[model samples]
Target: MRTFFNIAAFAAGSQALITRGDSCCFHLTASGGASGSVGQLSDGQNRIGDNSLSPAEFCINSGAITDGNGRGCILTPPTTQLQCDEGATPTGGFSIDSSGKLEFQGSSKFIACETGQNGGLNIYTTESSALSNCKPIELMADSCAAPKPQPTSTSTSTAVATSASTASATATAPATPPANNGCPTTLTSGNFEFPHLIVPIDSSSPDTAAGTQFNGKVTSTVSSIFNFDIPQSDSGKTCSLVFLFPKQADLQTSSFTFSGDGKIDFAALSGIATKSTTFHNAPSVSKDLGTIAVSPGNQYVVSTFSCPAGQTVSYEMKNAGSTSLEFFEDFNPSP
Candidate 1:
């Protein structure tokens, strides 16, 4: 029934004072204010539900309650005092009642969720969702659960689509061999400028040369040349050679063994070659550096290259195409 607000009551006007054995529960809501307060009540056994109590049993606070107007009419003794002081903030707290429902603070911040309290939380909506954004104040809880990882099986594959030119020599056709226009034809040994021309190993055989030959097939934009020739300089000076992959891709190879038959018959493969040049006339006096080689007719090998923007260069490599082989060498001049 109607519970009059008692200054000495448990939930203020929300519940009646326990007279030895008597007990009651109540729920509260702040319908009009920007923010509200709440409280909980319980005989520690039963719980209370919102508005379940008959209107007559409830009392309104004078300072906090109003008839929607300025000072219209403040209810009786208990109700008048139950009205919250003007601008008083609300902190909703709930407690269990004799039944099992929670009794909560009559003011607004719906923070409590026990019996006899306002269970008006829309868990998934803005108001309730706002709870997460609130600064977290710690209250020793049992434990925090570990976070779950995102599944990758269903994630999009990020394999980059690299170009073929990034691998083997793009073509066997010579691009007007590096300009020898200003190159001295008969300069003294050891005196030279760069953009140095590669000496082609001249031979009628397609695969036999003085040095080792690469045998794998290069699956790239470039093609292999039948003429294995790099014009030699004056000769007799030890030198080194380097090959670059103009772009980033892969060059697969089976092995690095070179056959003396003058061919490199590599297995399955992918190859990348950008700048591949042999150096001549260095100080290899009485020295012999074996040739670099790859194997497996079709095995792709890892390669790297970064070409400047605007200008393009072929980055490719060649392997024993089905059964192809290339030859190389380290030789001294004919004394």
Candidate 2:
């Protein structure tokens, strides 16, 4: 089966793609345009995989489809390959279709997928993989249902937020505590500037475990579960979760690659607990916030929720690309 770009039909933030029989999902080459023909992301797709990061943006606009980084997709002139450009002007606009014909721009030429010698799939705009002798591989990447998560018998949980700010030593204590309620209004994450820096934690490893050492680094890139000793403004007022990532300069000095495109990942609040380890390996309910990207230009990113009064809440982020989230006293008003 074949698919085409249907620009007019695409809704804002419409989701797309996951090739069947493959567990490997797509990632935007950290430096777009430099890695490939242009920066290639989920051309129009983001497949959620096992221990994967949250889905990157695969937004659709009337003019073109942008990558997770919000860079506009463009065609490389003289060559049919399409990619996201970095400050590079687009050669032309892209038209999409779902007629399953694999055609581009309604011409004799068709969209094609060619497997390179390096075993990479390259998208091109020349001839139909089927209609032409040029014969490219037809990668009919259809929509596949996301598989359900199985139980983690020896469950592990922790989260450190990613932000580009210097964290303060004092934590923001919870507001309007009901006499003995001990909800702190501020939370922060550990330092794992790069994925390699992430240290895994489990019950057996108290030094690394957030449950055992509640004051240890409160975040981990290695696991999806994050238990936060929150900054609960329990006055029935909203509470904020702050995330800090190393700045570009720090990342350069440390010789670490930027892990995420600065988009705040979605986290559903799972079980609340007196101790995070006690909540581990226990089944519980969860809350869902719809899809949206975090704007990190504010030095730090903040996510506010209905404060869970006196309890420490665990946000179950389902991706590894998600930075260790922290909590801040307040959101910066200036960019």
Candidate 3:
């Protein structure tokens, strides 16, 4: 039924060694001294390494085949089905069907490639386990593109004008100072509008008016607090006029105060009720400033403070309840 043999020595040059069994045969050959050798296993119509003549059931070759047909080693799975296993239980690592299609089995199944213009490629299954366990994939851009141009002055003038007009209407205060003994006799209000309202990008080119106008508005309902930056040129000057307007009636009962660099200047109410308050520059601890009240026609309260160069000052109107409030600032060279 079967026969086996072992040869320890063989002649050099070209030689053909063939062995036969009941259902399988093997062919091995060597040529040109000891340069290279090739071996093939086959069953009548099929060979192991070279599948050109028919189809190799199984074949193994180290170097390229020099046969007249120029064939190499090849392995073909069975026509029916094929399964891989570790030991007893079926692992199903990979399989080939009769049509020569390969399929993979398991939870995390994917194919990865390492060569591409951007990076690499990754393909994953759409199963629930893959979706829940895998991390998100990120996509990248191929190349950079130019940026969009900014708007010109001619196109944005209307919008800038409308915003500046609204801010001037709601934030502008009366020219006259409040009639209180505590208030300074002479004060100056700077012509500069709110800086926050102006757009800095327009200052350079194309749309220049944006830098010249104040077009910002800030409204608060819970607390009447506002902060603004004072330019370096006005550092030694004083903020002579800080005005507050109450949009709702409930704001009348609250008190307003201005503080800079962590020091409180003075506090005032909306009516004629006077209170002794401390001033940041006053030599005495407190002064009897008359109650801070809204002007009859102006409908706003005013306070004053010494401005620090290149620093932000804050004004707070507490106890506003649900009433909305508006605030404005004016810096004067003299006080």
Candidate 4:
């Protein structure tokens, strides 16, 4: 059976607080606080507020346990809260303030959190269904003291798609200036997948190199597998470079990188061919670039994004450049 929580309204402008506890879930709402102030509680460990409200000022050893997650104090109309156990899987908790601003809370020690429902609790940003902007926050526990020895399987699926082929195509086209191509301000799904690669950087000259470097060491590997899952769709993908570095000579400390929102030229990752190469300024190390390779688009799932082990999935890069390049790979899905 589902459990319903009780909440009490204190002063018309008083605040509320939520803390850490072990419960399946809780739903709460509260009102009152500074003019634009908002407050909420979830579980028994957390006490939070937003621009609309501030943290409770007065004192309390265990705070209110009224409307929200088991034992949280409230100070706003938009207050909501939730809490649960870390049994094998993780779960999420939630809160809504008096201004209708919904918030999410997750436990770091027991379970990790997600952005939407399915694991447990739900929250709405508005009263009307059409205007409701409710999202779920899923949390999972990877470790628990409870022992439930489950079977361990060896069959592995692709965490992400991984490919193993020597690409012969090269980046023969020259670098062009940025143009308006309807590229969305945000990179959601349906956009070109962010390309990953390793580039060789020269450190001797700091001003000119594409990235920074130190001592005998230079560039750093900026790689990740991500999920390109936006409902809206668009054209091809393009990438630029951005770099970060430290002051002294420490190979382990200082590093080089590609430019702003850069994409590691697959041709570079493949160590094959180049269309245009330039060096601007320097006071650091510089040298030949590195090799590039391609793995299964799904490999991005494993290497970049997160997914359950042994799950079958595929990924593709939308509007990719015509150039082909070499690629390395590995795909072991969890079971």
Query: Which regions in candidate 3 have their CA more than 4 angstroms from the true location?
Result: 1-191, 195-221, 244-296, 299-301, 320-335
Task: In model 2, state the lDDT of residue 52.
Answer: 26
Worst 10 residues of 2 by lDDT: 1-10
- Candidate 1's displacement at residue 78, Å, is 99
Ranking by TM-score: 2, 3, 4, 1
TM-score of each: 0.16, 0.28, 0.21, 0.18
- The regions of model 2 sitting more than 4 angstroms off are 1-221, 224-226, 230-233, 248-265, 273-285, 289-302, 318-335
Evaluated at residue 287, the lDDT of candidate 4 is 18
- Residue 113 of model 4 has an lDDT of 20
lDDT values, one for every candidate: 0.19, 0.30, 0.22, 0.20
- Ranked by TM-score, the better of candidates 1 and 3 is 3
- Distance from true location, Cα of 64 in model 1, Å: 83
What are the per-residue Cα lDDT tens digits for candidate 3 across 98-200? 1222222111122222112222222222223222222222111111111112222221101000111111111111112211111111112323343332221
Instruction: Summing lDDT over every window of 10 consecutive residues in candidate 3, give the lowest-scoring window.
Output: 1-10
For residue 317, what is the lDDT in candidate 4? 16
Which runs in model 4 stand beyond 4 Å of their true positions?
1-198, 205-335
Candidate 2, 184: how far from true, in Å?
Answer: 18
